[model samples]
Target: MEDEHEAIDRLSTRIDEKLSSFSTVSLPMCFKVPNLLRQTNEKAYEPQIISIGPYHHGKDHLKGMEAHKIFYLNRLLQRRGETGVRKYVMALKVKEEKIRECYAEPLDHNIDGDALVEMMLLDGCFIIEIIREYQTWNLGELQERNGNFRNFNVESVVCDLLLVENQLPFFVLSELFHMTPEPNQENDEHEATDHLSIWIDHEKLSSFSTVSSSGCSIFRVPNLLRQTNEKAYEPHIISIGPYHHGKDHLKGMEVHKMHYLKRLLQRRGETSAHRYLMALKDEEKKIRECYAEPLNPKFDGDALAKMMILDGCFIIELIRENQTETQKIDVDFRNFNRFSLKRDLLLVENQLPFFVLTKLFQMTGGPNQENVQGFIPLALLFFSRVMPGYGNGLVIRDQNIKNLLGLVLDSWVPSLKARDNYRKISKEYGGWNFKYSATELHEAGIKFKKIDHEKIVIKPEIDEAGNEVIKMGNEKSFFDIKFENDVLWIPTIKMYAYTDSILRNFIVHEQCHNNDTRYVTDYVTFMDCLINTSKDVELLRHSGIIVNNGLGDDEVVATVFNKLCDSIVFSKKSFYSEIFIKVKGYREKKWNLWMANLKHNYFNTPWALISVLAAVSLLILAAVQTIYSHLSYYKR
Candidate 1:
């Protein structure tokens, strides 16, 4: 017994050693945001003027920034003295192995240990110098730098610094800042621990308590549409998260964001911004974990909290500006020209987590002072003009929503009960199959009508097996299409240039986070199946089912739907399955086919019906004359 116990203990010790070895190689905090996503919008992920970290290091286009980096490094060394520079380099060298582990893949062999140390020294010093410049400017000790850096375009640099791939660990920067402390700046050290606070928190607010979380809210777009139009998924005007933070095209909107942030702070009175920042600081870990990719360590609690506070406040203020209609004298007039901006905010890439927005709103007297409905309603109102057929009689529960795009899609989807009804009816009918197009159905004696002012509500039912069965009634909107007496009732959809982008992003979000309930994908797939050619588009247009909003020729619309559905794999269990079964059943009936043939061949139009009636009358007259003549001959 003693010998057996000794052997078991040895085996357990070996297992523990192996587990410890595996844990030593920690998971990476940053990855090359998948090539599939990058292929769609290379500019969205790529740094334009400056490359912060080694990912795009030494590229020909980014070589120009090397001079600026050296300039910043020289400035940093001059201020810190030679001793401080050596101290920063030594601190980073000690963390070299650990820092390398933070990358998703191994760095190039050419970038040897010394090369990496040199790169970090240069990059980290440059970053510290820029932040110090910004800090001194805020303190009225130094003037704003001239050249391109003075323009609003320089905000792009700030954006580039925050990207997941373009980051240095927070501890490295914190060490450098501490080694070269500014004179009489002891009290500000806590706020200056991260680079983000220098740019975002100009007020120098003190740190506060933290918060807990339930789960993550952010997600990556599914890879399904990566090969399709990249612009459909890319944000045009603004960026929200680290995914597309800083691009040259989107820099114009930064001024607007700052403007909105200023207005939001003023509206909240004193200490509101501080309170908002503290609340966000508490929930920092939850926010970082919500992202699909692990965030760079530089996005420490304070850095993330500042981002959430600024971004959340900007969005809330935009919603408020649109809803209140009060003409504030200082408001940027370009913001009111919202057709493009509103669409930009709803893009999957350009979104803050919904919960963060709600937290900011509630804390800032959004519910009490605003007298508005809620964040969802305010968002709906702001986006209503761009997204037609939405925000009307729609109720979105907070728990059900994931993000802005998710909220819009959830509102458009049918309720759980309605989907269950579809499944049950589809099962009862033995399976739903694809049928004819709108034009073919019309030829087969089917009619088309538009549904207006009807609300679709779902009711619950229980079966004998104790399972919940969805009993569909007229009160609920089942599928986007409904067939009654060969008449297909479809709601009108207005198509615009951004319509495809909205649908594509919504589908991506649905596929990524809500795969089980793919309501949007099912609807798009159904529409794609129904419209095979341009003639199908024309038929729907004539039937008042499709309203075009400068989307070009009808053929283009047909091609859009066809291409949108390309490579898309939809579940067989769809909300439209039952409607499809009914249409197929009606088309298969021999009596219905014969009646349709009669209608088409003899009574298709008023002129054709009149000709047939005249001929029948003439035949009756000829028959009477022949009978009279036969009677006269018989008498003779």
Candidate 2:
């Protein structure tokens, strides 16, 4: 009838007293309950004795006592309120204060849950309650109270703390803890982390997965912090070795220590083993949440990235296994978040060994080479996530790469073949680029013509307002625009057309200059160069926003256009028309001067130079002809 804590503490003290009789069982306090060894046959507590190994205990009786003690302690903590009843929780709060002092700076969000759990595991119920209350108190409606959001970290800390205790079965707790908040801010943006729920060893993952694992996957890390420090390990590998009997054995599997870790610290000016331990303690207390978890099923891409940074090999292995397993299950890629994986691909693509990358590229489905190539945007963002300034290991910008993708998709694939795919893709409601929409005819003295043997042609029609209209057929259709050197690449009607109009207009206006001399296709090199230039502009814009919000005129124009585009895409036809009108007005105002200059400059210098050279040659020939004529007259 008494609480579990009261009963366990009494039993524990009796065991501790008895354990003292054996010298081999030194450090009895290091374990939870000292009584596990009191009896040879521990059938009563046998269910709890998943593992029993001696660190210093050599005597058989002492070893048995150590196991018994740990068994009781593990049981005590497993039930939430047991430790609190024993008054150990009060001491835990004091210990937590000591733990806090270990870190130089206020702990970042990463360490909150882990720290709380570690403190709880060491201290007991009162301390756990205090931490929980502290978190809860911090969560009041007031701005000040809301400022330090501690409650969110509590579950994770508790979960992780329990995990590092390494008392629970691996897959059991692994499945028990893998959950996250919504990954992306909005549904439209394909965010990677939107609440990860991981499945491992065929077990269901739980919420607050952060507390349930010892290390996080690299993908779960924020883009900015993944590279700031290097002391952290990527907990990527999980040994599924000879003793694959149960979760306990698997959970306690040793993480292969980095051989260079000591050397790294020493080189970084850590003088002694004590100093190294101090730094590690600080990292564990402040950066790690009492404990951390390895990448698991519920880990969002950001967590996955973090795990990768800690241990790229482990995350990649899991990814390979998961992808294979998921494929076997025929799971849709759309169902689970894919963005979390983007960072991993980027991290391992360059940092890991070549064999790893080769193996990753070898994964079935999607042309390995093309998938690797088209996934540059995903890669660039990922490296930026792991290490922001870590360039894509190449000079290419995202836009340039996109253009390059366009060219590759174009030059390598014939238009006829692409058109076929494009036509087929147009019919679907959501697959690929197909979206269901009603088409209307435009009228401006033009007609919509369906060439029997050719692609659909736009012939204009005069609407009631005498405006131009183009009518699409009764069937829903989408144009299959390959990433080729065509209108598809020009930011027109597909992809991000309206938002990128300024950019598109710039490309076209620049192309007009080249077009005066040669056909548009003939001057592909010129288009390529402009595409590169525009990409630089976009990068500069993004960089400006990142460093300092610079509300320049161009930025204003771009933002307004983006807003208008968003409205058009999300709003009804009436709203789209109004937005389109504003867009046209803005486009006209923005490009009037640039367009005029483009026209004036188009045929001016190059054409003038050619004309002058021709004139000079003609003059020289005329003079020679006159001289010959005069010489002939003199001879006559």
Q: Highest lDDT: which candidate? A: 1
Candidate 2 per-residue C-alpha lDDT over 1-636 given as tens digits, one digit per residue, 9 for 90 to 100: 578989999999989888875544322222332354537544332212112221112332222122223332343334432221122322333445444443333444544543343323323322233344455563222212321111122222233234222232222222212211113232222222211111210121122233333221111221112222211112222322111112353243223212223333344465443432333333332223321222234444343323323232333333443434543553333343333232213321112322222223333224432343323332222222222111111122223221221221112121343334434543312111211100100101111121111222223344577643332211211111122211112211111212132222222222212111111121122122222232322432332311212234444433433332110011011211222232234334534435534434443368865776798899999999999999999999
Over 4 Å off in model 2, which ranges? 1-418, 421-498, 501-611, 614-635
For model 1, how does the per-residue alpha-carbon lDDT over 1-636 read when each residue is reduced to its tens digit?
999999999999999999998798877776788878878977678765577767878775556456456556555545543312444555676889987887887788788766677677777777887787787563112212332131113445666787767877676677777766654332222223333323212221111001112344565443335556778878777777666766788777777767777776676566346777788888876677567555656667777787777777778877766667753564575454457666777777677877788777776654453322356656765665576443222344667676777776665666455665566675433222475776566767778776653433323345577644323233333235678887888777778878888777776665445255467677777778678788889888888778889887889889888777643435446667677777878876898778767767888689999999999999999999999999999999
Error of 1 at 222 (Å): 2.7
Candidate 2 versus truth, CA RMSD in Å, comes to: 30.6
TM-score of each candidate structure, all chains considered together: 0.57, 0.18
Top TM-score prediction, candidate number: 1
Clashing pairs in 1: 210-282, 211-282, 456-477, 457-475, 457-476
Instruction: Rate residue 44 of model 2 by lDDT.
Output: 32
Quickly count the clashes in candidate 2.
Answer: 83
Give residue 319's error in model 2 in angstroms.
41
